[model samples]
Target chain A: MGILEVKDVGKRFGGLQALGDVNLSVKENTCHAIIGPNGAGKSTLLNCLVGKLIPDTGSVMFDGQSVLGRSPHEINQMGISRVFQTPEIFGDLTVMENMMIPLFAKRDGSYRLHAIKSVMNERQLREEAEQMLEEVNMLDKRHMHSASMSRGDKRRLEMAMCLIQRPKLLLLDEPTAGMARADTNNTIDLLKEIKEKRDITIAIIEHDMHVVFSLADRITVLAQGTPLVEDAPENIKGHPKVQEAYLGEAH
Target chain B: MFGLDKKDSTLLILVAVLTLLAPFILNPFPSDSGLAQFNAGYPDLMQRFVIFGIFAIGFNILFGLTGYLSFGHAAFLGVGSYSAVWMFKLLSMNILPAIILSVIISGLFALVIGFVSLRRSGIYFSILTLAFAQMSFALAYSVLTPITNGETGLQIALDDPRIFGGAVAADGSIPVTNLFGLEMRSAFDMAVGPWSFTFSAGYYVCAIVMLIAFYLAIRIFRSPFGMMLRAIKSNQTRMNYTGLNPKPYTLAAFVISGMYAGLAGGLMASMDPLAGAERMQWTASGEVVLMTILGGAGTLIGPVLGAGAIKYMENIFSKINDNVLHGWFAFLPDGMEDAVVWILHPFVGKGWHLTLGIIFMLVVIFLPGGLVEGGQRIARAFKGKKAKETSEKATTEPAE
Candidate 1:
């Protein structure tokens, strides 16, 4: 059984079917990629898994617990971390401060009124955050404001933030969607390093086939809200339906 | 020193020194001098300065940290005052219970209001709070007349049961608000040459309370909870996706600020022993907003500085009448003096708000971070100038 199981999930936005009978299972300790053409429900399926949307027809199970009705934060606490396409980060906070937030969430659950206790007094969290920053190659920029950093660094920090939680399921919604070739290469390398080093199950929705073929152990191709092919990455590379619908348009 | 880092410790000490010697510092002008009108050492005004300072400090925690703009905070202030006045009537004339009751009641009031208003964010949230405050003002003015005393306001009565103390003094007057046996209005007068200062018991009481409030604010500003609030302000989406609920945090901030406002209201009642519906008016809520933004919303000392500045201007400029102007411009030609006074009329007296408005506008336009940013810029400029001079001296010495 996979860590995440989406059973025939279907969703509608008004009259249009945004996601239609989407079935996806992301197994533990494997990098799974969901690649699709425009309006193919890649993001719709990701949203359903993260509890941003309630699938009208199906159940989303993360290790047997339903994430359908739960709020995004609750689902996050349930060991699912989402990295947004635009790199959502606390821009007003410093890099180190941004790093400490997830650590605090992981330790303190959803909410803890640690009002009087100084953030600087959290020596353990501070050290862990520093270590995470080091791992992401952002330790030198720890004191810099997260907003003022380069886009690449912000993405790195965001990834590090997600990684620090050690979430059971890491959902990346276009991690390198708008990156330059060099930055995209760096990100792919980072993902490769993370996959090799950690026991994390990643479920990424991407349009970049190079990124998909490089890291994905399993690839699911979707066309018009339905999975066209669910196979190993090596098999997905040669799949005629995926080549005709998605890979044909990109390159 | 008090669990604060060195920088925060220094700031607390500086504020402590300033407030402790406010009488001496504020009364720079001698009593006999014409500039004595500018002196803010009197008990009434000093009490107001500290009380409003406390209010602004609390308001800053929500608006400054979490970026939640609430426009109904004055309702809490009003509620606090009414509860305190009620406490004085039903329980005791002592200020402690009244202040405590004010904080508690206001916190409860804020909880309800914040819960409702925090459902929306940005301008919608602002409107919600404003609507709640207006509703509160309307209720306090008309519907809640029996409890609030309508337009005349709630006042301590001679017939009421002061369960902890006497209802009326032996002299046939209601006892004033006191701290134990010490009266809020009592003061020690000191005269040296032409200089004189009145250190009122009420001013000190208000000052001590404000100091505690300010210290607590500093602590909150440095805490993990504070960081979370800032994070929410930065990006609510990120905070949610990161598994932190922003709603409860914001509600806590709103409630805390409301309690602070309540404490201020209680202190106001402790100083005067009256509660009025006007205290909860929308304009009163706006004044605290102005104070927080004017002082520098996010900075620790900004709100207090803003409160003091606004109160000082209100007192000093409003007191500058035609007689005072005429005295100053006596040497000018009659026509010129009249023209000068006429030209300055719109910026002084009842029109002092125009001057404050202009200053606030300038501060907002030029220093978006508020007065704290202005101070930082000035400090940086001075440092830059000094560094240039030192560099010039080094070059000139080598040339010589």
Candidate 2:
């Protein structure tokens, strides 16, 4: 069985049938990409998987456990982390402090009240956070306020925050949505490096064909809330159905 | 020393010293001098300063840390006062049981209110808390008369049974609130030359408690939990997705601050054994909010400074009638003096709130970070001037 299994999932928001009978399976230790045009229910599907929304029908199982009816924090505690469309790092906190939060969550469950113990004296956690920052090449900027950082740096910091948890499954909803060419290439290389070094399963939803072709082991093209095609990246490149749905009928 | 770093420890020590020496520091002007009217060392006013300091400190813990602006915290204070008065009547005249019972009861009240109010956030949460407090005020004034003593308020009666201490004093008046035969009204007067300082036992007790509260607040502000609260304030959505629950953390902060307010109320009743429903009015709640924002909401010492400043102004400004204003501006030309008094007339006497409102406006607009930021700006300007002078001297000396 795959690490994350979705079966016959369906969702509706009032009059709109956002998702209808969708099924997806992401294998362990592999990068799976979901590519679709605008308004194809990519975000809705991601929300369903992350417990931000409950599917009207069917189930989402992570590591053979049902992930439905749980909170976002609970799903995160179960070793699933998500990178949002926009970076969601704590803007008011320093980068080092931002990194410490996910580490604290991983080490001490979701809700532990360590009120009396000073965060300053948590030498082990501080060192771990600093080491994570170093790995992201953000050690120098660790003391700077995160909100003042550039967009590329914020995304990098956010990725570090998620990865520090060592989540079993990482969900990326357009990790490099709006970026300069250099930053986009940097993110692609960083994801490649992460894939080479870690035993993680990444399920990314992307609109960028370059990002999809570079990192995806398996590609699924979705259109109008249903999967149009699912195949290996090389196989999906010349698929007629995908071209018709995503690229439009050019030529 | 109490899990505090060097800077924090020093701050705690400074605060302790200031509170311990308040009687001396606040009575700088001599009793016979013209400035004697400005002296804030009197027993009644001094006790109030410390008591309200405790109140503001507690309010800051919630509003400062979590960015949750509660508008009904006075209900907790009122609850605390009623509990303390009940303790005095039923248990004993000893202040210990009264204070303890007040804190516990107010904590429970906070739990119920916080649990319900925390379900909603922002203005809804504020409105919910306000509604709960107003409901409590109405009940205490009407339906809950037997327990709260209604409009007359809860006062120690002559026939009350004292379990630990005597029911009545030798003179047959109601026994004053005391700690092991040390009366809360007891005061010591010291005369040095023309200046006279009055130190009250009650003021010292309240001041020490305020110091402890302030120290505890400093620890909370620096703790991991405090970080979590700040994180919540920064972004609740990010916090939730980061695998941290924001509700329980905010509720805990709310309850802690409520207990602080309750402790202040208990101290107030201990100093003057009376519990009135008017203490729970929405305006009283607004006063603590003003104190926190005016002093510096998130800063450790800001709330206390704000509380002291407001209370001091309340006492001193309310005493200034047109006669006082006229006397101060008498040196000016006759027409100018009258003009000055006309401009200042609406800001003194019963118009002290108008002055407070204008000051609040100025602080909110110019010093968004409150009085703490204002002080920091002044210090930085001085330091900058000194640095410029030293740099110029070094450059000129090298040129010569």
Candidate 3:
């Protein structure tokens, strides 16, 4: 059985059917990519998995536990961490401080009052954050404010934040969206390095075919809220149905 | 010391020194001098300075750290005052029990108010708190008259059944609020080198309490809980996604600040032995807000400075009659003197609020970080000039 199982999930928003009878399973320790045209419900499906949106009919199981009806923080506590399309690092805080938050969350669960102790004196947490910054080549910028960093640096800091938790499943929603070619290649290399270094399962939703082909072990093509095809990268590239869905009918 | 870092310890020490020597520091002029009118060494005004400082410090914890602008905090203050007055009427003339009871009662009131108001965020949260405070004010004025003593206010009466101590003193007068056997009104007067200073028991007690409150606030600011509150302020959505619930943290901050306001209210009643419905009015709430913002909302010393500045101006400016204004501008020709007083008249005395309003506007507009930022800017400018001078000297010395 796969680590993540989506069983006939469906969602509707007013008069529009955002998702209808979507079913997919992602095996453990592999990079899975969901690609589709605009308005094809990739984000809606990701949102449902993360508990941001409740599916009207279906269950999302992560390790035999239902992710539905749980808060985003609860889902995160259950070893699921997501990277937003636009990096959501704490702007007013330093890069090291931003890294420490997830570490704190991972160690103390979702909500523990560490009120009396000074955060500056948390030697262990600070060391862990420094280690993570070094891994991302952002150790020099650790003292710099997160908001002052470039777009690429912000995305790297966000990835470092998520990775510090060592989440069982890392969900990336268009992780390389709106990036220059160099940054995009750098992100692909980082993902590759992460996959080789850690035992993590990645589920990424992307519109960039290059990003998908470069990182995804298995590819799922979604069309208008339904899974059109699920196959290996080689099979998906030549699939007749996938071509039609992307390029539309020629005649 | 006091679980504070070096900078915070220094700040606490500074505040302590300032408060302890207030009678000396505040009374800079000789007793018989014309400028003695500006001396703020009297017990009544000094008590207010420290009490309001505590109130602003607490407000800063919530609004400064969490970015939750509560408009009904004065309700907690009123609740504390009412509870303290009731304690004095029933328990004893000692201020200890009254102060403790006020803090606890106000904390509970804050819990209920915070629980309800925290369900909504942003402008809705503010409105909910405001509505709740208004309701409390109305109830104190009319509905809860028996407990609050209505418009005349709750005061010590001759027939009050003081269980711990006698209701009346040996002189057949209502008993005064005291700590142990020392009365709150007791003062020591000293005269040296043409200067006279009066130190009162009540002001010292309040000053000590304010110092403790300020110390605790410094600890809280350095704590991890404070970081979480700041995280919530920076971005609640990010906080939630990072596995932290913003609601509980924000609620805790709100309640803590409320208790601070309550403590201030209790101290006010302890010093004067009176509790009035007007204490909980919306304008009182606004005054605390103004104090917090005008001083510097997020900085540790900003709120206290703001509170002291406002209270000092209120006391000093309101005392400036037309006669005093004329005395200052006496050097000018008679016609120009009249023009000067005429221009400044509306901004002094009864028009002191107009001056305050103008100052508040300027601070908000130019110094959004409040007086603290303004201070920082001036300090930075001086530092920059010194650095430039040193650099120029170094460059010239190499050539010489």
Candidate 4:
């Protein structure tokens, strides 16, 4: 059995069926990519996995446990972390302070009243945050206010925030949706470094074939809210069904 | 020192020295001088400065840190005052139990109110808190008459049963609130040349309590819990996805701020043993908001400064009537003097709110960070533009 198993999941929003009878499995310690057309329910499927939306009829299992009813934070605490399409760092906090929040969450659980102890006193967490920044090349911007940073810096900071959590599963939604070529390549390199250095399973939804081919170990082609094919990138690249789905031609 | 960094320690000490020497600092003019009208050294007004300081400090924790604008915090303050007065009536006139019990009851009250109000956020959260506070005020005013004494307010009675202390003092008057044996109303008068200062026990008690409250606020600002609160203000979505629950964090801050308001209310009742339903009015709640914003919402010392400025103007400017305005313009020609006094008339005396309104408007528009940013601008102008360190500090979050 794979680490993550989705069994015939379906979702509806009002009168529209967003996802219909989707089944997928992700193996442990491998990068999985989901690529599809705009209206193919890619976001709907991602939301269901992260507890943002509940599937109307199906089960989502991460590891051995059903993750259907868990809240977003609870799902996160169960060793799953997601990077948003937009960089969502704490704009009103310093970069170093932003780095320390996930560390505190990892140590303290849902809520801990560490009101009397100063943040400066968390010497070990501070060092851990600094080390993470150093690895991401954000050490120089550690003291800078986060909201004022460039978009690339914010994305890098967001990536560092997720990586520092050391989650068992990492989910990325359009990780390089609006990036230039250099930044996109930089992000690919960073993801590669992170995957190589850590025992992590990554699931990415991407429109960019370049990013998908460069990183994903397995590609899942989704069309009209159903999985069209699940295979290696090379096999999927040459498939007529995949080409037709992308080019909007008659099959 | 005291688990604070050097800058925060210095700010704390500066506040300590200022509050301790307030009698001397506030009363800079001689008693008989015409400028003495501006001196805010008297016990009654001085107590108000510190009491309201504590109120604004607590309000800042919730509104400033978590970005939760609560418009009904005065309900907690009113509850605290009522509970403290009740303790005085049933128990001893000593203030320790009264104050501690007030904090706990206010905390519980905050938990109930915060639980309901925190379910919504932004303007909806504010309106919910405001509705709850209005309900509390209405209840305290009419429905809860038996306990709250209706419109007459809750006051210590002469014939009440006092198990621990006198129902009535040895002199037959109702017993005054005290800390052990020291009376809250007692004061020491000192005269040097033409200058006279009254060192009030009541003001000192309120001042000491305020210092402790301020110190704790500083600690909260520097703590990990404080960072979580700032994170909530910045982005709740990121907070949730990072595996941290924002609900419990915001609720905890609400309760902490409510307890601080309770402490202030308890201190107020300890000084003057009466609790009125009007204390819970929405206008009173708005005043603390004004104080927080006028001083600088997130900065450490902003609320205290805001409180002092408002209280000073309320007392001093109201004391000025047409007579005082006439005195200042006495040397002018009769026609010009009358015209000037008439022009200045609406801004002073009973119309001090007008002055406060204009000042608040200017501050909000020109200094969105509040008075702290105004001070920083003045300092920046003095130090010149080459001061890169200060400019860098300005770029950072104005949470200090």
Candidate 5:
């Protein structure tokens, strides 16, 4: 069985079918990319996997546990973290403080009632968060406000925020959507390094073909809320249906 | 980052020392000396300073952290005052039970309101709190009049049976509040040089409670719950997705803030031995909100400054009349004196609202972060123009 599996998922928003009959599996210790055109339900699918939106009919299993009915925090506790398409770092909190939030959740198991203590003084969590920030090349910026960072740095900080929990599966929604070309290349390299170093599964949704082609071990093309093709990147590049459904339209 | 800096500590110590030596400081420019007419350290006004300081601190919990603008916190205050008064009437004029009962009752009240109001966030939640507070006011005015004492308010009575303490004096007065049989109004008088200072036990009691409340607020401000509330304010959707429910955290904050309000209310009733329905009015609620906003809603010291500034203005503005105005312009030429009176004439009596209104507008417009932000700006300006270089470096650094 795959480490993360989506079995025949179907979702609707009122009369509009956001996703239909989607089946995908992410293997352990591999990067799987989901590439699609706009309105192809890529984001919607990511939402369902992270427990943001419940599928109308489907089963999502992470590490053999059904995540369909769990709250987002509960799913996070089950070791799956998602980086939003936008840089969703807590802007007002210092970069160090923002990272401490997830570390607190990770160490305390999602929800904690302890309202005392300097969170930064928690030796174990602080070390872990600092280590993660260092890994993301953000240690130098740890004292700065997250809001003050460039868009690329914000995304990088957000990524570190997710990784600190050491989730079994990390979901990325267009991680480089708004980044400059140089920043995008840097992010691709960072993801590649992280994938190579960690025994973690990754499922990413991306609009940029370059990022998908560069990092994905296997790529799935989603069109009109359904999977058009799922195969190795090189094979997907030449698929006739994928060409007609996405690239042809893009060109 | 919000840690108490040296300036803050110094200001606090100054305020404390000044409060401790108020009899001298307040009387320095007495009206009889042909100087300022305001004697701010008078017992009644000083009592207001500490009491309202407590109220604004509690208010900062909800408004500052979560950014939920409540318009009905005064209702909680009123409820607490009423409960404290009842404690004095039935139990003893001991403040401990009254304060405890007030806090618990206010917590329960806040729970019900928070449970319902938190279902809808932002402006809707604010309106819901307002509606509930208005309903509470209406009930206190009419439906619950027997218990709340209607417009006359709740007060200690000599005719009532005192279960714990003996009956009140023939003047229909209960004894002044006591702490373990020690009279709260008992005073110590000290004389130095040309000044005599009176320190009342009641002020000490209020001051100690205010300190504890302030400490608890500072704790809550730095707590994990505080971070969660700030997260909610920053981004609710992201918080939900991060696997924590916003409702429970917000509800807890609301309840805590409500208890603080209750404590403040109970303190007020304990000091005066009366609880009026007007305490729960919308305008009263609006005053704390104003105080919190005027000081700097999210900052720890902001609300206290806001409360102090507002209360100081209230003490000064309410006392200004045509005679006082004429006194200021007594040295002016006749036409100028008349012009000054004309200029200041309409802004007295109930017209005190106009002064407050203008101040509120100015604060909100020019100083969005309130007096706290203004202070930071001033400090930043005085530090010199070179700080912008450091700010550039600061922005590049990731704060995590």
Candidate 6:
């Protein structure tokens, strides 16, 4: 059995079926990428995984547990973290402060009462946030407001935010979308580094073939609300169905 | 522009000093003058300053942090006042039970409102709150009149049984509230350079409460829960996807803010022994919003500034009439005086609201962040440190 599994998941939005019967399994600590055309329901599938949307049919299982009916935070507590398509770091807070949020939640597993004295200054949480910031190469800019950062820096801060939660599974919804080519390459390197250093199972939805090829251990091609194929990246690059559905159409 | 690291303690110290000397400073105006008529240093006015400050501070928590614009907050305040008045009527004038009951009842009202309202986000949520508030107001005005006393408002009467400890007289006039037998109205007055500086016991009580409220606000602003509330404001979807249910946090904020309004209402009743239905009007709700915006919405100090500024203007403006307007321009030639009066009469005399309307429009248009931004711009213009640092940071950073 795989660490995370999707069994015959289907979702409908009004009269439109956003996702057909889709099945996939991700092995432990592997980087998986989902790619599809604009109308292919890739985002819908990602939302289903992160508890943003519930599937109309089938089940999503993480670490042998059903995640279908759980709230996002409950799912997160069960070791899943999501990074949105747009960089969604708290703009008013500093980079370090943003990182501290997930870290605090991870350590305490509760949003503390506003009336209570804060527990964020706990030594372990502070040290962990600092380590995560340094890993993301954002230690120096830690005090700067997250909103004031450039687009690439914002993504990096968000990455730090998600990673600091220390989730068993991390979901990225187009982490490199709208990024410059250089920034995309940096992100690829960052992912590669994270994969080597942390015991995290990552499922990323991306349009960038270069980013997918650089980081993904497994690739899933989606077309018309169904999985066209799931294979290793090398095999996916040459698959006939993937070519017709995505690659050939792209070129 | 005023960097958080600015070490000038003098400004804060000066403001503190001014507050300390307000009684003497405020006494210089002629007692009958328009400005003097609304002098907040007077027992009634001073009480209002602190009480409304509490109301606005609580409001800032919800509107400032969460970006939820609640149009019916006055209902909570009114409910609190009514509850407190009932405590005086049914129990005794002992303020502890009244204040406690006020908070609990207001919070319960807010909980019901928040639970339903939070189901929908954004403008829908705002409308939901407004609906609930209006419903509460309507009920209070009509259906619940038996309890609320309807348009006449709820008041303590001589027939009220003094079950709890309070200042009751043999003749049965409504008793003054006393804390452990010490009257809140007990005063300490000193003569200072041709003026009597009076620091009434009630003023001290209000000040202590205000300080505690301020400290609590500051603490909440710095907390993780505060961070989550802000996150909800900025991006609710993002917060949800990150494993947070924004509903609980927002609801908590709504209830907390409601309690603040309740406390303000309770204090108002305590200061004076009557509760009015008019206090629950939409206009009173709008006044708090105006205060929050005018001061500076998000900043800790902003709401207080907003409340004080608006209240000060209301006092000064409402007192001016055509006669007062003419008195100011009496030395001018007839034609010029008449022209000045013609220009100012509509806005200042009976039309003080016109002046307030224009000011509100100007602030909303030019200073969307309110007086906080205005203060920042002024500070930035004075120091130029803000500009220099940003340009330097820009130039020094390497391209990613």
CAPRI-style grade of the A/B interface in model 5: acceptable
Error of 3 at A151 (Å): 1.5
The best candidate by DockQ is: 4
Which portions of model 3 show Cα errors greater than 4 Å? A247-251
Per-residue alpha-carbon lDDT of candidate 2 for residues A114-139, written as tens digits (9 for 90 to 100): 77888899899999899888888999
For residues A1-251, write the lDDT of model 3, one tens digit per residue: 78999999999999999999999999999999999888989999999999899999988999899999999999998888899999987888888788888888888877777767888798999999999999999999989988999999999998998999999999999999999999999999999999999999999999888999999999999999999999999999889999999746333
- C-alpha lDDT (0 to 100) for residue A16 of candidate 5: 96
* Candidate 4 ranges beyond 4 A from true positions: A248-251, B385-400
Cand. 5 TM to true fold: 0.93
lDDT of 3 by residue, B222-326 (tens): 787888888888877777778777888888898899999999999999999999999999999999999999999989999999999999999998999999999
- Model 1 C-alpha lDDT per residue in residues B1-400, reported as the tens digit of each score: 8899999999999999999899999999999998999999999999999999999999999999999999988999999999999999999999999999999999999999999999999999999999999999999999999999999999998998789877998799998999998999899999988999899999999999999999999999999899999999999998999999999999999999999999999999999999999999999999999999999999999999999999999999999988889899989999999999898888988999999999999999999989999999999999999999999999999889
Worst 10 residues of 3 chain A by lDDT: A242-251
Residues A1-251, candidate 1, lDDT per residue (tens digit)?
89999898999999989888888888999999998999998888888888788889988899988898999999999999999999999999999999999999999988988889899999999999999888889999999989998899999999999999999889999999989999999999999999989999999999887898898999999888889999999898888888898888877
Better of 1 and 5 by lDDT: 1
Docking class of 2: high
Instruction: Give, for candidate 5 chain B, the lowest lDDT window spanning 10 residues.
Output: B1-10
lDDT of 6 by residue, B82-170 (tens): 98888878787667788889889999988888788888877897787778777787888898888988888888776676677544565
A159, model 4: CA deviation in Å? Answer: 0.8
Q: Which consecutive 10 residues in model 6 chain B have the weakest lDDT in total?
A: B1-10
Q: Candidate 4 has which clashing residue pairs, if any?
A: B299-B400
lDDT (Cα atoms) of all candidates against the true structure: 0.93, 0.92, 0.92, 0.94, 0.84, 0.81
Which parts of model 2 have CA positions greater than 4 angstroms off?
Answer: A249-251, B332-336
